[model samples]
Target chain A: MEFIFVLDILGVVAFSISGVLAAMRKGLDVFGILIIAFATSVGGGTLRDVLIDTDVSWLTNMTYVYVIIITTIFGIILRNKLNYLRKSLFLFDTLGIGLYTVVGVEKAISAGLPPVICVAFGTMSACFGGVIRDILCNDIPVIFHQEIYATACILGGFSYFALAYFNLPQDLIFIISGLIVIAIRISAVVFKISLPKVY
Target chain B: MEFIFVLDILGVVAFSISGVLAAMRKGLDVFGILIIAFATSVGGGTLRDVLIDTDVSWLTNMTYVYVIIITTIFGIILRNKLNYLRKSLFLFDTLGIGLYTVVGVEKAISAGLPPVICVAFGTMSACFGGVIRDILCNDIPVIFHQEIYATACILGGFSYFALAYFNLPQDLIFIISGLIVIAIRISAVVFKISLPKVY
Candidate 1:
């Protein structure tokens, strides 16, 4: 649990930096950049909590708020260095989504939702923060037409349920599920893979 | 209460029809159209309910589901005739926002939120459905750039609180706030008015 918490914080930091980068490219003011960072870091989890009728974590947890704010500050000051760090940023984002996918599925299970809904929640947890950020920035969500992002999260969720059914160690199932997401995303980007478009 | 219920149904119908039109123009398929219709009709209220930590109305109540489905069917079947009804369609859309602004303010009050937050909630409820619809269709939201739409809702919310402070009847306050929204929208369109952009 402590390990997962640390990964989650790392994910938030990576996502916040990405948000700042995107907002800066759009020429948004500092306030706008902060909001974009907020939306990117915690938007998915907030949506999942709302649907499951739980208290929104960021509203009660000051840690996320502080982390994102601090991250945005650093991202802005170090914007010039970010270009050199793209590869590492991508790695951090993949890890973040992997952890978030497992976290979302676990929360859904605790809420007593059905299997399909749990998988949907998992994907939502990992993907919708980017979706919300893209929407705020007036772009079509990358997952909708271009990336294999949500697919990786969905597959990881399926693996989690499958491992649990086989009576695997709970910690093993969690780690493997997250690792699968990370592996798939990294491979997709490296291989220039994408989802096929109907149009 | 019955009158409010009737108005709410009308608002749902109007928003759903608008959603259908937007999807049709975007060349979305039947399934896509239905999803857009659902989002535009209930997305704002759902966000509000989620933030307030209340039972999401559409999840528990079948009325909204039935209303949007029926509205979409009619909207698709009568798309050609819809052009002739542009004036009436705009009227319906305006009325819908007016009702939603008041409904959102009322809900925030019930949740015991502060006045400024209530106004923000009111504007969000009146605008975010269309915002979501536009985002899904990959367009910048109209309210974000050119329209005075959200401003009307915010002002109406302020009016709601002001009237309440004066010890006006609850029903009167509700009706007046809604009327203010409708009037502002109509006047804006009639005079070709717009919100000034910083750029």
Candidate 2:
């Protein structure tokens, strides 16, 4: 449980930095940058919680809020330095989504949602923050245009259920499912894999 | 109760039309048009419900979905005609926000939220659908840029509480509060009133 909590915080930090970078790239003011960062770090989980009628996770606990704030500040200060560390940032983002997919799937299952909806919610929880960020930035959401982002989460979600079906230990389920998501996402980027567009 | 139900449906239909028109104007495909219509009609109320931990309104009752579908089809078929009838559409949009504000305020009050938060929720329920529509269309939200949209809802929310404080009947409160919003919005359009930009 404690390990999952730590990973959750790491995810928030990773996503917050990504948001800050996007906002800075867009030349947004400090206030706009902060809002974007905050939204990107929490938007997915907030949407999931709302859909499932759970208390919004951040409102119930302030740790997420603190992490986003700290991340945004550091992200801005190190903006230039961070430009050279894109690969590292991408790794953190990959890990972030991997951990978040498992957390979202578990929450939906605990809420008694059907397996299909649970998997859908898992993908939503991992990707919707970036969706919100891109929308706020007035750009076509990257997920809609390109990238294997949501697909990775969906794959991870299926793996989670598969592992559970085999009666894998709960802790092992978390680690293995998260690794599946991370591996798929990282390989997609490294190998330049992308879904074909209809048009 | 029946009257509020009717008003709720009206609000949904009106916003759905607005969304369909926006999507068509952008030359989006049929699927994109329907998605935007659905989001614009339900996004605000969904946000309110989720924040307050209530069952999502549309998921619990299929009527909202039906209305959006029907509205979207007619809206598309009547797109050219609607351009000439912009005034009527504006009136419907105005009434929709007014009724939505009252509904949101009442729900928040029933849930025992603070008065200020209730008023904020009221405004959110009235405006955030359009916000979602704009975001989905990859544009800066109109509320943040131009117009007196959300301001009218905020004014109506305050009026609702003020009228209630004076011990007005519930029905009269609804009528008077809604009128205040409609009057403010229509006049803003008529006079071309808009919030000033800082930069």
Best by DockQ: 2
Interface DockQ of candidate 2: 0.14
Give candidate 2's error at residue A6 in angstroms.
Answer: 19
Q: Write the per-residue lDDT of candidate 1 for residues A1-199, one digit (tens) a residue.
A: 6877888988998889888887777666554576679889988998999889887777545688889989988888888899998887888899999999999999999999998899999999999999889888888777898768899999999999999999999999999999999999888888978988885
Query: Candidate 1, residues B103-160: lDDT per residue as tens digits?
Result: 8998988877778668767877888898789888887555655546777887899999
lDDT of each: 0.86, 0.86
List the candidate 1 regions with Cα displacement exceeding 4 Å.
A1-45, A48-53, A57-131, A140-199
**What DockQ number belongs to candidate 1?**
0.13
TM-score for the first chain in candidate 2 comes to 0.96
* Per-model chain A TM: 0.98, 0.96
lDDT of 1 at A41: 90
- lDDT of candidate 2 over B71-155, digit per residue (tens): 9888877777887877777877888999999989999999999889999999999999999998887878889978888999999
Backbone clashes in model 1, listed as residue pairs: none
Q: What is the interface RMSD, in angstroms, for predicted model 1?
A: 5.0
